[model samples]
Structure formats: C-alpha cells, structure tokens
Target: MESDMTAALIRPVAIKLDEVTKARVKRLAEARHRTSHWLMREAITQYVDREEKREAFRQDTLRAWDEYRSTGLHVRADEADAWLAELEQGKDIEPPPCHK
Candidate 1:
C-alpha cells in the first residue's frame, strides 16, 4: 500500500489574526451564516487540495523519469493495457498490488 507519512506529522496550528483581518473574516462568515471556524476549515481544505495536486504532479513527473531511466522507455498511459483488457473481458481482475 502507498505509505502516507504526512498525516503522522500534521498538527493543529493556532494563529492570532490582526483586528482588520479578523473583522473581515468575521463579516464574510456572518454573511455566509457560518462560524469563523467553519470559514477557516473551508480555507484550509481548499489550500490542502491545491497542495495535494502540486505534490501529485511532482511525484508523477519523478516517476516518469525513473521509469524511463530503468526501462529505457517512457511510461505510457496505456502501459496497463493487459490488465485493463482483462477487466473488459469480464474477468474478475484484482486491483493492482501496491508497494509500501
């Protein structure tokens, strides 16, 4: 299975915002009928989603390079054609195994 080390190192952070920023955020939250905490969580969730996409892109680039170096060919999207074909044939193909 893929190992996710990020979750182990995550911790809740508390920050004190300046009065102006707090007031703006409070106003925004009030308009939306949501608490400050809900607004903060929503902002954090969006940030995390963007960061995850960036990280995934980086990882895929590296993986493509490594695959090319080791196999002397670029990794193609259809590299798993055999496995996909098996599924299309109504075979009960198991999920591809993962590594730690």
Candidate 2:
C-alpha cells in the first residue's frame, strides 16, 4: 500500500521554461542545496496551497455577502472593533451578537 502511494506521488511532469528562467531556477536550486526538480516541485506545491487558500477565502466572502443580503443581520463595525480591542487587552469575552 505504501509502495503504491509512493508510486502515485512520484510521477514525472514536464514543463517548459525559457533558457534564462531555467538557468535562474538551477542557480537558486543549487544555492538552496536542492535539486532543480525538488525546487520546482516545492514551488508548485506552495503555489497550489496558496491559491487554494485564496479560493477558499473568496468563497467564504461570497457566502458571507449572500447571508448578509438575505438576513440584513450583522454586527456594527464599532461594536466589532470594541470586541477586538477587549480581546487584544487579554480579555476572553464572547463576540458581539449580530443584529438586524
């Protein structure tokens, strides 16, 4: 099972890069004491992770907007700020309740 997982994870993917960009990647990889493949893999992984989080945030924002439009219930900015200020001063109070 582990061997199958390893085999699935270690597939080869080819990407094209300009000569200058390729040289830069090679230099950076060498400076970081990592292989070019490893550096590119790390770059792709980080990019995907960041983009996934960004997409999630975008979705959450949209859902929040929809909910606010439908219910017209939300905390005032001043109330939220006061709550945050209390928390920053080490208070462990609950958040302000949402209102219409």
Candidate 3:
C-alpha cells in the first residue's frame, strides 16, 4: 500500500469504468507521461491513504470527546491560541494546562 513501492511484488487487478471515464483516464495518463494502469493504482493508493488518516482523526476526536465528558477538564480557546502563537514565534513551550 505504500505509494513508492512500485518495484515490490505486485498483482493484477481489474476495474470496470464507463467509456467516458475510461477515455478521461487514458488522456490524463498520456498527458502525465504514465500508463493508465499506473494512474489508477496511484489514485487508489492515495484514496486509501487519505481515508485511513481521516478515520484515525475521527477516532481520536471521539476518544477526546468521551474523555472530556468524563472529566470536564479542558483548556480555554484563548489559552490554546496563546500557546500556539508562542510556538509559531519559534518559542518551544508546553501546552496550557487543561482545567475545569
């Protein structure tokens, strides 16, 4: 599933597309100096990678929400903003303490 693993072992896979979409893929492949197979593989790989990241973020958000509901401990928006601003200015510091 790594995008740069072209030289590794591979297998043949088939997909069916409408004629118009097939033509578009062909044209784009030619324009990009790549084969249609390569284009499709790249697209699928990127889609999977992006979806995995999104799912991980969703899970993390749910976990955080649950923890907040349990403890009611959180940082204020202004405090977070000031901490981030300090980091943006090249200052390394810990995040503001979370409290009720």
Return the candidate ranking by TM-score, descending: 2, 3, 1
What is the C-alpha lDDT profile of model 3 across 1-100, one tens digit per residue?
A: 5765864667787889999999999999999999999999999999999999999999999999999999999999999999999999999999999999
RMSD of every prediction:
9.4, 1.4, 3.7
User: What are the per-residue Cα lDDT tens digits for candidate 1 across 1-100?
Assistant: 1246766666788989999999999999999999998898899899999999999999999998787677775434464676688899999987554322
Indicate the residue-level lDDT of 50 in model 2: 100
Taking the tens digit of each residue's C-alpha lDDT, what string does model 2 give over 1-100? 9999998888787899999999999999999999999999999999999999999999999999999999999999999999999999999999999999
Q: Candidates' TM-scores? A: 0.53, 0.91, 0.87
Which residue pairs show backbone clashes in model 2?
A: none
Please report, in order, the local distance difference test score of every candidate based on alpha carbons. Answer: 0.81, 0.97, 0.95
Backbone N/Cα/C clashes per model:
0, 0, 0
Best by lDDT: 2
The window of 10 residues in a row where model 3 has the poorest summed lDDT is 1-10
Q: Tell me which residue pairs clash in candidate 3.
A: none
Off by over 4 Å in 3: 1-9
Candidate 1 regions exceeding 4 Å error are 1-13, 74-100
lDDT of 3 at 81: 96
